[model samples]
Target: MASTSARDDDGMKERLRQLGLRPTRQRVALAKLLASGGHRHLSAEDVYAEARRAGIQLAYTTVYNILHQFTAAGLLREVVVESGRTWFDTNTGPHLHVLDEESGHLQDVAIDPKALPLLNHLPLGDDVEIADVEVVVRVRRRNDSA
Candidate 1:
């Protein structure tokens, strides 16, 4: 049994259409994987591996390309946890993240809408304004054993 029903597939098509991307089979398959999970932060490699396991024979480069396309189209958010490690977050809205260093896990951290800090001081010309902000807090598990 496939996790995506016909209606769900149609919704996925609309999602891509809204992004001005063609709703190909590959895009729909990738979108289903990303959206089926509640809210996910997956690397391109993660998606490639999972797709292979799920019997989708797409190349790893294809996954990266699709992820980048989605990110550029505002369908996904890219969170850089470190120099080379990046996660494609399913949530595109403004939010914060708490990263577990030990397990390499990322989770969304709730932020109070009223508690957001105001950014001041401009280093750019008059035509510049801030549009979006991202904050990631890294954490580690506290050792319980003495």
Candidate 2:
């Protein structure tokens, strides 16, 4: 089901409307791509390719615009795990990421908030909310693992 495109026949319209976005074909298709089957750390290019393969008929600018809108509205989290690629995650919870240096894949690594030391010495003047603390643990894959 993850690979199958379920946008057209599914009830994606209602979902987008609930998020205060008008349910257009482009928005519905993008929303379904983000919501259904499985969660992923997708890049804009990844989303554009998927939408194109699904015959969603959207320009690259349209995809990027909708993604920015969704991120601004708190529907997605954008992370820069690598140089030149920004990843979008459907999961909004505070967490860290483990990026495989060899494969360039990003994976979530949950951390206990209590485990972190208090940083009261630093001056954060009431305007800062620590949304995410990402520790990109870069590791090379073992030769014998496969």
Candidate 3:
């Protein structure tokens, strides 16, 4: 498990380089924002907001471009919730995203691995491998006033 985690780190670094990103301080910070939090579900705007809050000097456009690069490189998963908000997920592995509609926060939900066979029944070709399965569950916060 430890070895696998180390490999993931190395792989991320390589991916940034391959994507033509300099892997500078800002890039590393951005990567950490995604990786360190276990799994994050954030839109480009969300990331930019957090970066600003964290005192990272990178512009919002820079964060957005970096996010697109990461998504293209398979380092992140892009999801659109029912609210029509685009969210970027730090967890690139197979998992489900649970969107908190009330708070606009997203969480990772566990799913049974056995169900993958059923997905194969779809029209997708044999070469297709599921990267991430986004299941945005919408709910409103309970009004305590009631």
- The best candidate by TM-score is 1
lDDT of 1 at 71: 94
Off by over 4 Å in 1: 1-4, 112-115, 118-128, 141-146
| Per-residue lDDT value at 36 in model 2 | 68
Off by over 4 Å in 2: 1-18, 112-115, 118-132, 141-146
List, residue by residue over 64-101, the lDDT tens digit for candidate 1: 99999999999899999889999999998778899999
Candidate 3, residue 102: the lDDT equals 66
lDDT comparison, 1 vs 3, better candidate: 1
Position 12, candidate 1: lDDT = 89
What's the lDDT for residue 142 in model 3? 83
> Predictions ranked by lDDT, top down?
1, 2, 3
> What range of 10 consecutive residues in model 2 has the weakest lDDT sum?
1-10
Q: Report the lDDT tens digits of candidate 2 across residue range 1-146.
A: 54334544256776666778788777877887788647579889888998888788899999999998888767888888667878888877766677888788898877754345764455667988665555556678679957
State each model's CA lDDT, in order: 0.86, 0.76, 0.74
Clashes of each: 0, 0, 0
Choose 2 or 3, whichever is better by lDDT. 2
TM-scores of all candidate predictions against the true structure: 0.81, 0.72, 0.66
TM-score of 1: 0.81
